[model samples]
Target: MTWMVTGGAGYIGSHVVRAFGQVGIPAVVLDDLSSGHREFVPEEVPFVQGSILDTDLVTAALREHGVTGVVHLAGFKYAGVSVQRPLHTYEQNVTGTAHLLEAMQSAGVTRMVFSSSAAVYGTPDVDLVTEDTATAPESPYGESKLIGEWLLRDQARATELHHTSLRYFNVVGSGTPELADTSPHNLFPLVLDALAEGRTPRINGDDYATPDGTCVRDYVHVADLATSHVAAARALSEGRELQRVYNLGSGDGVSVREIMTAMAQGTGIAFEPEVAPRRPGDPDRIVASGEAAARDLDWVMRHTLTEMVTSAWQARQAR
Candidate 1:
């Protein structure tokens, strides 16, 4: 079955597209290239350069590609920036998702795997967030994702759409040296970029109650994340039952200090990180249990922290 991968030219989307190719699944790419690089898309895949906001363009792409399923990944993704650009975030994520769903309906495409975020949970008080965790999104980016899920649910109730949203946190690492995380806001990229520029990476805060006094978060490799997306899409295509959402997370988390040590070891940049004040609203820790996803979506953290840093650093240097 052929699938349409929105934002397929992006770092994470490109990895997902590559995973699909490796598994012998036919796929086409639809991306506006606002944040994605055209070069990230493979030469052999059909590429449609357009925004998901355009229902006509989306519908046409789905029809033209004979897309049986869609993996929605295109959206305004920066949580910190989303706070400053709430309207832009909603327009791109919430409205864009609605338009894509509408286009899917028009094109008779009924299966989808939405690339959601753990930001939907905000700063959960729970030690290990489960699928049943309350969704109290703090940023517009998170809120938009939650709304997108709601739109999919409502549409599913009214139509033949079968879908699942994968909520994940701090995705890192590279599946291939050619495909790397380029997000400026992500921890790995930020640190790697700083080191490449001969600047010391700074820790946001080191006064939290955690072991190292820095924040703790679940970090998953991008390739493992991509495989789970493929599994989710395949499940939907094969009429397998799936929950409305699943958390792609590591039950045990690594602290920001641990990441800093790993980065220094992986990059051989033995400089001490500058300690800075905590960014407002920063939680002490946020980790989720991937039990649901592991059971249904083939979720797994296949890369160690050192491997994540090394692969990411190597990719950044290559770029």
Candidate 2:
């Protein structure tokens, strides 16, 4: 059965698409190209150039492709930018999800895998965040993603829908050199971009409560994340019951300073990162336990932190 991957032309989306193909599943790409590159999508795979906000186009694509399920990843993903542009974030993530669900119902597509975010946990007051962590998102982007999950939950109760939402932390690295994270807001690109340009990479702040006095976050490789997405899709397609939500994390916390250190080793660029004032809404630390995901979704951290940086650097250099 064919599956439609919304935002499949973007970084993480493109990796998920390739993972599905490797598993012998046919996938079609539907991306607006807002933050996605046209070349990121494989030429062999079918591509629909449109937004999930366009219900009619999505419905037509689903019906035409005979798509039996959907991997929903399209949304406004920048947490910091969402603070200043909440309305735009809502329209893109919340409204876009509703519209996608509407189209799925119209086309009788009953299976879905939603790409959620760790931001939904806000500042988790725990050593390790879990699926049961109380959701109290701080930014509009996080709020929008939580709303997206709710929309799917609400819709599933009323219709023939089998769905799962994956709430993951910072996603970095690349599955292939051809598919790089092009998000200007993402950390891997920002640090690598600065280094490539002979500019000093800047760490947001160095006054946090972490051991290194910088924010500690969970960063997972993109390829591992993509494999898990496909696993979730397969579970849904096979009529296996999955948790409503899962946390795909490393169960480890890494500070910004540590990331910078890894950046230097990975790129062979020896320079101290400049420290800047902490951005608003940044938490001191947030890591997650992937126990549940590991048991169910075949989740595993196959790539080390150094591998993450080096792979990301390789992709950046390829671009």
Candidate 3:
């Protein structure tokens, strides 16, 4: 059966698309290539150059592919940047979601795995977050994603659709060499770029209450994340009771200093970072418990933090 992968040309989206292809599940990619690179998509995947907000284009693609399901991944995802452009964020994340759902229903696609985020939990009072955690998203980006979940629920109530919104935290690492994040947002790749240019990677804050006095967050490999997408798709295809939401994470927190040290060890480079003021809306800690996903989807993340960082560095060196 063919599936439609919105944003199938971006870093995480491209990985998910490749996973589907590797499993012999045919996929059609709809990407505007705004932030997504054309080179990231696999050559054999059918590519549609368009936006999800384009209702007619999306509907046509869905019908053309005979889409059995969708894995929604397209959105503007920079938390800090969302604060600068809240309206743009909402239009892309929320309005675009509504457009996609309408198109999906029109095309007879009934299942999807949404790429939600742990950011929806905002700064949870507890250090570790679960699916049941209260959501009080501080940034428009997080709020938009939470609203997307609401949109999903609303659609399910009115249609035959079932969805699994996977709330993940700090997606990192690289599996395919060609699919590495060439963008400059993520921590690991940004640091690698700085060190490669003989500049120091900046540390945002050093006085947090964590073990190393830096903000802590969970990091999961992109490959493991892609694996969960396949699992979610299979579960829905089998007509199993769909899990409305699941957290995909390592359930362990890694600190900024710890990550820097890991990078130093992995790349054989030692340099002090320039300590700077914390970026606005930066959470002190965020670690998600993936127990529910493991129980329901039988998912396991085999990549270690060191391995994730080293693999990213390898991809960086290749670039």
Candidate 4:
């Protein structure tokens, strides 16, 4: 079945599109290119360059592509930045999602897989986050995602729509050298950029209560994440039952210091990272259990920390 992938020209979205292609599914892309690169989209896929905020454009794209389903990934994604740009975040995420859902209804498309974030948990006190974990989002970005899920749920009750949201932690690495995480705020890009520019990467606060006294976070390879998205879409298309949400996370976590070491090893930049004060609101550790996702969405952490770093570094260098 053909599907429409919002933000399909983006790093993560492009990988998801590629995964769909590998599984012999035709996919169309809708992206405004606000943060995505047009080059990331494959030549064979139909690309509609427009924002999801435009109901007419979204509806036309869905109709034109004969879209049977959607993978919603377009939105304002930076958590820290969303705090300062709350209105912009809501407009892009919350409002945009509403518009897309409306367009889907207009086009008679009833299946979707929403690309959500782990930020919805907002520094959970638990060592392993489960699907039942309390959602206390601390940022507008996270709040908007939760609200998007709510919108989907409310719409599902009123219509024929079937959907699932995939919440993921730190997404790193590359499925191919042609595509890389280019976000200035992401750890992999920031560290790779620093090393490429001959600057030492700095660790924020090495005095936490965790092992190595540094913050630990769940990191998953982007390819694995993309595969799960495809699985979720397929499940919905096949009328398989799915929970409202699933966390795509590594059962264990990797510390920031371990990341620094991996970066050095991967890039062969042997300089030690400088220690810096912790950023405000930074949690010491946050990890999630992917048992639910693993069972339903084909979730798995297929890459090691070293492999993640190496793949990311190689992609950055290629870029």
**How high is each candidate's TM-score?**
0.99, 0.99, 0.98, 0.99
In model 1, pairs of residues that clash are: none
Best lDDT goes to which candidate?
A: 4
Residue 181 accuracy (lDDT) in model 2? 87
Residue-level lDDT tens digits of model 3 in 129-209:
888899999899999999999999999999999898999878888996666777668898889999999999999989887
lDDT for each residue of candidate 2 in 138-197, tens digit (9 for 90 to 100)? 999989999999999999999989999999988999888888888898889999999999
Query: Superposing all C-alpha atoms, what RMSD in Å does each candidate have to the true structure?
Result: 0.6, 0.8, 1.0, 0.6
The candidate 4 region of ten consecutive residues with least summed lDDT is 297-306
Rank the candidate models, highest lDDT first.
4, 1, 2, 3
CA lDDT, candidate 4, residue 187: 90
Error of 2 at 271 (Å): 0.6
On residues 1-319, what C-alpha lDDT tens digit does candidate 1 reach at each position?
Answer: 8999999999899999999999999999999999999999999999999999999999998998899999999999999999999999999999999999999999999999999999999999999999999999999999999999999999999999999999999889998898878887988998898999999999999999899999999999999999999999999999999999999999999999999999989999898999999999999999999999999988888898888889998899899
Residue 99 lDDT (model 4): 97
